[model samples]
Target: MDRSKYTILVADDEELLRWSIKEIVSRKGYRVVVAANGREALEVYHRDHPDLSLLDIQMPELTGMEVLKQIMAEEPQALVVMISAYGQVERAVAACRLGAQDFVCKPFDNDDLLRRIERILEPVRLRHQVEGLLADQRQRYAIDQIVGQSESLREVFTLIRKVAATPNTTVLITGESGTGKDLVAKVIHHQSARAEQPMVEINCAAIPEHLLESELFGHEKGSFTGAGERKLGLVERANGGTLFLDEVGDMALDLQAKLLRLLENRTIRRVGGVDDLGVDLRVIAATNRDLSKRVEEGAFRADLYYRLNVLPIRLPALRERHGDAPLLVRFFLDRLNREMGKQVRTIGEDALACLSAYAWPGNVRELKNVIERAHILADGERIEVSDLPAEVRGGGAGGAPAGVATATAFGLPEQGIDLEEVERRLLTDALARTQGNQTQAAALLRLGRDALRYRMKKFGMLE
Candidate 1:
């Protein structure tokens, strides 16, 4: 490590001890700041903000314990080590309780003192690194990271902004699988008052019912078979932050009741623990299932349903937001290009049209997957229709007409024909045979009248 970046503070009333510490630490390439008394220590601390501090217990103006308390109150993360004589071991213990990192004895071996300081500073270095990583992750999940231009998606963004400003409001996001429900939950948490705190997530459906209770509420040591030590549950871990209960509809009825209690009381009891520990957190629950319908069917609790439905935000399915497909395609394309180190820039018109027309049953997630796959398989600078998945190219449910094989009456050609043009001509021919009779034309085309009318409108053959 480059010790030159670190600054250590040494505060001692004894000049000899203070000089000794400063000499030893400064030789390690660290900048050293010295203070002759506790009061001077606090003054230097506020001004310099050194990475670590070493203080003698028996000081002039203020004692080390008092100085430690003041430092902790001002800068909670400040690293301080107490220096005490052999007769002052009890006072050093007191200093540790007051947030001192570690203590060193007077007439202390220089090597032992140096080792203790290194141990304390090691965790501080690690914590800074971890915080940096977490900050980067939070940026990735920011509210603006969600991509879509459709009006329905805009409305969802409006709701997210409104709900996020209210730190304690419980959010219930309902949507189909792959519609970015989990992303929405994270956006809410990261943009809320508890953004600096941790956000704990649990997939209710992913965990087996037998072990879910212990997972949510935690289990005490020896609470069950093979329970070796106490474990903090997701609820306790999420205290003062956000708890995202994903696929909550799949949670068992018994566990649902326990969760309802926790929501109502803002307290949770571990599996085998007798005490009820209070928790302060916002609950954001998500599910693809129709919870109201489940309540009517007696599978879900009506009371819990009402409680969670307070700030309901329903996400529009990808098919419902057809206008967003092209934008989402470009978004994922750019992301995959950067990630996979591909030069695929723009998409071919045919590929773009195919993507816009397809009914993405899996929603935005499936679209992202398709884009990634295309980026990987693409041999040119642009993605072509042939680069897409067969289902997408066929456009069976997505919006295009059935594949060219459906036009086999004229035998298969070496090159495939446009399915939309073929379907349009077929519709016109059917209508012509029926003299423009709507019902008769539908029967000739082997399609329902409504289906025929929709096709007519889509092909611009309708007046």
Candidate 2:
């Protein structure tokens, strides 16, 4: 019969305990490596590169905590369960503090041990499945360009597919400024039947209210003083495609009525032309404002809001997408490296930690800008904490003056803290827990190995 394959490492001073763990794990369709001392454990760990480890806390030549530290330094996400005696609970807690995934007493029950292992491995397995799907979507539809591996982004991807395929739907995408609302609109349009046709985008807030109507509906020559010839409006151009109205909440109240009419009747009259032109278009609108509040205050039209909000997609802010920061950072790093002709290959773990913990109110667009700035400032192939923008490295002192309340509300790090140092501590702890395995470290950090490495060097962890 075929069996699932997993590799495990067992390190203990006593041969009996080592053998016990080895036997237990091996019986579960895993290949096992046994080490009698800390030095041997490190050697086996490096040589075997096991998927999981069972480490004894007390060992000759090196303490389990010391071994754990070294393992974490190398592979921040390595899955290692620590073993300690009942009296040595302090050591077990210390191991946890240092980043051990789990701990068990020396007189451990085999079933309980198996259960702990299962709990740790289950998420890893599920994460892998999710990553596999993301990778496939990236290749199949260029979805990877969006650049996030977080569960939140996965849900977003799922929702995009569902909402985009629905015919004749009006989708209102709401998010803070620079959260990639336009990109989401494009992805939806690309996935829909309108892929072959044009996707016309209009920024309602940017355009003057007087000119908006003329832009939406084509104007005939002599209709306006400056009108030179008969021109097709965006609504007419997007007849068989999609029209993305950005900052829809900012549109003038009167124009909202016209938009509502067009959505309901699927027809438009040019600014000066009398004939009504029939259209078959899909509307996908986005706004940074709270339309509901606007409606209550009479700042926005309620009927128009209802018409555009048949489907709503709210994007998660960068802070809410907890584990995606590092992934996106790596992507930006690679992109900047190529564009700038720089060989910057790594970021210190601490620097990455800074980015992960900091609340990016500006979201993905801000992250990209920060990375580009860091790339330009980097003096070597690696990006250092120093390379980060002064605003970020200064712990929000120089940047926009959003107070601690804002940070607390959005789950950002405290203002004026050493972001790089905080990142370093988090990365160090995660690595120590995982026992120096890069792949596991990535999983713990919710990043890819390349991302982890880039950050590791940026924080001055590299030789």
Best by lDDT: 1
Deviation in angstroms for 410 in model 2?
A: 19
- Return the TM-score for candidate 2, rounded to 2 decimals: 0.56
**How well does candidate 1 score on lDDT at residue 440?**
58
Question: How many collisions between residues are there in candidate 1?
Answer: 2
Extract clashing residue pairs from model 1.
358-398, 359-398
lDDT of 2 at 342: 84
Across residues 66-180, which tens digit of lDDT does each residue of candidate 1 receive? Answer: 8999999988878999889999999899888888878888788988877877788887778777777778867888877988877678889999999999989888999889999
- C-alpha RMSD of each candidate structure in angstroms: 8.4, 26.8
- lDDT by residue (tens digit), candidate 2, 1-463: 1114567788898877788787887788777888898999999998988878888899999888899999999989888889999999998998998889999997889999988887888777776676676555444455456778776678788888897778578899998788789988888877776776778999998998899999998899999898989999999898888899999999999889889999889988898888888999899999988899899999898889999989888886676565788888888888777887888898987677667655566879998998898888888887777777655654543332223223343355556677787678868887889877654565555554566777899987756
- Candidate with maximal TM-score: 1
List residue ranges in candidate 1 displaced over 4 A.
Answer: 1-5, 10-45, 54-77, 80-113, 196-198, 218-233, 269-277, 395-463
**TM-score per candidate, in order?**
0.70, 0.56
